[model samples]
Target: MADDSDLPQVVNRPGGATVGEQFRELLEARELIGFLAVRDLKSRYKQTVFGLAWAVLQPLIGAAVFLVLMTRVVGVDTDPVPYLLYVFVGFVAWTYFQASFTSASEVFTRNTDLITKVYFARLASPIAALVPGLVSVVVGLAVLVPMLLAYQRSPGWPIVTLPLWLLALFVATLGPALMASALLVRYRDLRQVVGLGLQTMLFVTPVVYDASGIEGGVRWLYYANPLAGVLAGLRWSTIAAAGPPTEAALSLGVAVVLVAVGMFVFRRFERTFADVI
Candidate 1:
């Protein structure tokens, strides 16, 4: 028999990868990400009779509830944009944020088998969860495209800045996702806390209502919240209206700070993940 030991081995590596090297390695692992993403999609809607319809249906239902509350109960003013569009934009953005956070928190725990056996980057687990949410966000955006066209609303030059806004949103939400996922390995209660906190934040955020609706001390607190910029940008993009510039800037700045801290924390804790998780 030929000496098989001479064959070049493709051993999988894990952490200690520089950010740039991690990204390149991640790109090389695209097939793994795709497989996990498809598995997640299938598992999420698996037993449900509605299947993929759950994607559109869940957000639509959420928007309807918000529309009723904003228009009837609170009587919040929506500028040129219809209440449906206003709520839909916030709901969709928030959905992506919340989904990313919750999914990321359990990444290490859920992928223990793969992590224990595989040679791929540990970052892949959290990154893979993002794929399903990204698909949902794109599908959700497509649903809005027709509505915008029907309304004859022109997004104007302001729409060009969307890429920046999206980057801000990604980091704002992803900070918590990375932080929470890393922490959850040690403290499981963090997951429940994150879930409840996100729910509370939804009411406080300018999602169903405009920022003008907040007043007094509450207004300052809202501006301090990292989600303020993302929510404002979502409204600006879909409604073609500008939010309070100063508050939006502050919010975006805070999000950047949070992301920095989150990155530091995640890196610090990552070494122990294999042991704890």
Candidate 2:
């Protein structure tokens, strides 16, 4: 996987390139993107005792802890739905986001040697950063089916929209991910900030609790966070829970804006990445 013989050496000079052209470089460098993604996946799991098991186990353990705390101690009410099942679905989605985001944020810093020496579209770095997390999310979903059956639950009609939900989540994640990855090229401390921000984001995003649980005007908080609607959509498509939140549209808009800003910011600094790094 470390082999870069086939990797494109095309320099990604920002110059007067429009944002669309710079972003399009991501598509144009498809082979390089795939190569980087595979290299990243190998790098992440290489030489580990448990290897990829860490990906599966990390979310499982997180869900179990949340289940105990939310179910036994706090007694978070999911009603006919078992708290474990409810939380696991949410955990899987969060794991995808957090894992992808953390990796994307560090793409530049971690690939200093490559960026400083080679010539390839840096956008490939962020796009590649996103691929490996899907391994965990897909495995989590496979594990979810049996639990759903044990609970005598199924995904229902909304399951057909699962891919759509995943696409939306991916698009939404691209916002911070691109911004974080691009900014970290210059501000190395941003690595620590991205981790802390995501940690604080979990509680606010409703991963361990249902979005519907929040009532009254305060509910606006849920709609304000982009992850809320994406998570809600994931739950709706996977678990066939209550329909998506009333303000799901608002969250989607927020996500779109984040992506736009992230791209703008990333491009603004793109020309300087190689020299600065």
Candidate 3:
């Protein structure tokens, strides 16, 4: 046999990575992704007194606040459905998007040590960050179901489309999350910018107010926000509210585009992550 030392060795550069290869790598590393997700979930609530109950509590508290401010104080019209039901639905959907995006944006920086030491797909980190929020969404929905029953309301056939709206929400959130995380590796200050931006987004997303409240050019402007469609579609699906279906469909298209652009940006910048971060 030839000497082992005489054999040639090949090395691949991270910079030359393609989306297909990265996606395949992510698929191959699914078990590790699941482990990271579970680790994050456990770590998040490890010492907390309420544990997972915090997930249910957060949306409940937000719904309560919006119920008071929107119904009692501001007198926003929810029409057929009670303001409580409408606002609660909004809170549940918004909470998931908010929590998932926030965690994903920090996935890279928060796990710098792991990224530097491991040879796994970096996309796993952001994808894993989505798990806790998804768990929370389930918890929140459990709470919502009882409230819907208490209100003597049923979601009707439109509820069947709930999964589609959720997928759109995920795409909308993932795009921004990936873009932010990629940029954040180079500019640490983006963390605060993201926080402030999310706060601003909450107001524009129709969480507490109905999309119909705005008209003229302003309504179209609001419709332009991808999240506006998600919240509209979610409300339409769950509470049978007259959500702007056309606007929401357009927003879904926007979300798909955002996902493509986000992946492109992420793939372009990911090669430098290990070196710069």
Candidate 4:
């Protein structure tokens, strides 16, 4: 038998870790993230009878309802991009945002067993929360191109930029998610507040309508939301004829600031999770 002195030593850092340390842990714990992501997928969909089909249907059903409303009741205008495709793309992108937010909020609350018992990369939980719904988003986008062909529409030259827009969507989502997850560990009530905030964000994000439809002076405010730019990019990438992403610079700037602030808040709160959580 090996002597206790010869055993591997695990460094214990209470409170929280530094940024570089956190990054290293996250990199080292990529497998943990994958495992957590799979667990999330199972708990979210597989446990249910319909399984992942529910994931696919939820967005489609919501989009269908909104499509009827936007085209009929409100008579909303989304020129160049067909109203059908516009609503579908917007719903798909928004679904991932909603999922990421909810998942992030529960990162600690859902894993109290692990958080209290073991030492691993706490950061991985929030990052993994962003993954499970991504499959639905990918499926939605893949389905869109075929829909366009069915409708006799062309994706045009803008299709090449689709990857950038998809990347932007994940970028826009990750920071807020991490921040939300950390905050929830201390303030569980924030779950409802954050959920309400997301609902407000959905209406504000031009998902059911176009930014051009808004009044000019206040349109800049709408562009300040990073998801607005991302949503615009998604629309443009898939529709080709859709309007350019307005105020692209301002939205990108806001996204960077959001990421910085979220990281700051998350790091500040993470140190106390094992205690208060």
| Model 1 spans > 4 angstroms off | 1-35, 38-52, 213-220
lDDT of each: 0.76, 0.83, 0.83, 0.82
Better of 2 and 3 by TM-score: 3
**Candidate 2, run of 10 with poorest lDDT:** 8-17
In model 4, which runs have C-alpha deviations exceeding 4 angstroms?
Answer: 1-15, 215-217
Q: Residues 152-245, candidate 4, lDDT per residue (tens digit)?
A: 8987788888888888888789878878988999998988899789989988888888776666767788889999888888887787655555
* Per-residue lDDT over 221-242 for candidate 2, one digit per residue giving the tens place of the 0 to 100 score: 6687888998888888888777
lDDT of 2: 0.83
Candidate 1 backbone collisions, by pair:
none
| Tens-digit lDDT string for candidate 3 (66-171) | 8888778889888987888888878888898888998898888987987688778888888888777878877887788888889888888988888888777778
The true-structure Cα RMSD of candidate 1 reads: 4.1
Q: Which ranges in model 2 have alpha carbons more than 4 Å from their true place? A: 1-16
* Every model's TM-score: 0.82, 0.90, 0.91, 0.91
What's the distance in Å from true for residue 27, model 3?
A: 1.9
Distance from true position, residue 128, model 3, in Å? 1.0
- Name the candidate, 1 or 3, with the larger lDDT value: 3
User: 30-50 in candidate 1: lDDT tens per residue?
Assistant: 888888888898898787898
